[model samples]
Target: MEIRDAVPSDWPQIWPFLRDIVRAGETYTWARDETEESARAIWMAEALPNRTLVAVDGDTVLGTAKMGPNHRGPAAHIANASFMVAPQHSGKGVGRALGEYVLDQARADGFRAMQFNAVVETNTQAVKLWQSLGFEIVATLPEGFNHATKGYVGLHIMFRPL
Candidate 1:
């Protein structure tokens, strides 16, 4: 498998999985009914420093990630990122590879740290993954998310130095 910057031609492969994941409302904070245009606008890298990446085995896109500043101006030194692996590809190390690459990329971009502002607490896999990657739960907003099936759940703010 190869991990590299994503291009427009990759979107057709990415959208199907991305749409399914978002509509599941299991991990991401995006609207369950997120439109294709809106999702594309957010997932595709637009300018310097920000990036969208893909993990592919030949022509098959196994997963994707987006990384950039967690905030603007004074807080821009901190990076933020999101990841999604196709359900069929989960457990094959795609997410971990993406995480590691994003960390390296963020450091290369001069980021001091990385922060995840709203990690759904019930997503134990992600919680553990981030923790294993040296991130710590800085705070948890009690009952911050209204999960589709689990109802109210905490949203954890995770952080780690680049």
Candidate 2:
């Protein structure tokens, strides 16, 4: 699969899986009823230094990722990113490729570090992936995430120097 910057045309393919993932309320912190318009606005970043990318095989979109500054102004040197893979593509290295790509992209963008502000602890697969990619759990807020099936769980703040 090839990873490339996403285009508006890709949204038609992206929204279905993105909607399913967000509505599942299992991992992401987004509102369970996230609207298509709002999601598009957020995911299709057009401003400078912010990017949205897709992993595809032929015409099929396997996964996506968005990356930008963790915060503005003085904190802008740190990068932040989010990822989503179609359920059908999970366990097939789609996420790993996106993670590696995002990390390299962040470094190339001159970020000093990468920080994930809210990672649901119950999402063990993701926790393992990030850890394997050299990110550390810098902090965990007690009962910070209300997982769909696991009730309240810790929310981790993961960090790694780029």
Residue 3, model 2, lDDT? 99
The CA-based lDDT of model 1 is what? Answer: 0.95
State the C-alpha lDDT per candidate. Answer: 0.95, 0.95
Q: Cα RMSDs of all predictions?
A: 0.6, 0.7
The deviation in Å at residue 85 for candidate 1 is: 0.6
Per-residue error for 17 in candidate 1, Å, reads: 0.9
Which candidate number maximizes lDDT?
1
Residues 26-101, model 1: lDDT tens digits = 8889999999999999999987788999999999999999999999999999999999999999999999999999
lDDT of 2: 0.95
Model 2: C-alpha RMSD to truth?
0.7
The collision pairs in model 2 are: none
Across residues 26-105, which tens digit of lDDT does each residue of candidate 2 receive?
88899999999999999998976999999999999999999999899999999999999999999999999999999999
Note the residue pairs that clash in candidate 1.
none
Model 2: lowest-lDDT 10 consecutive positions: 144-153
Candidate 1 TM-score to native: 0.98
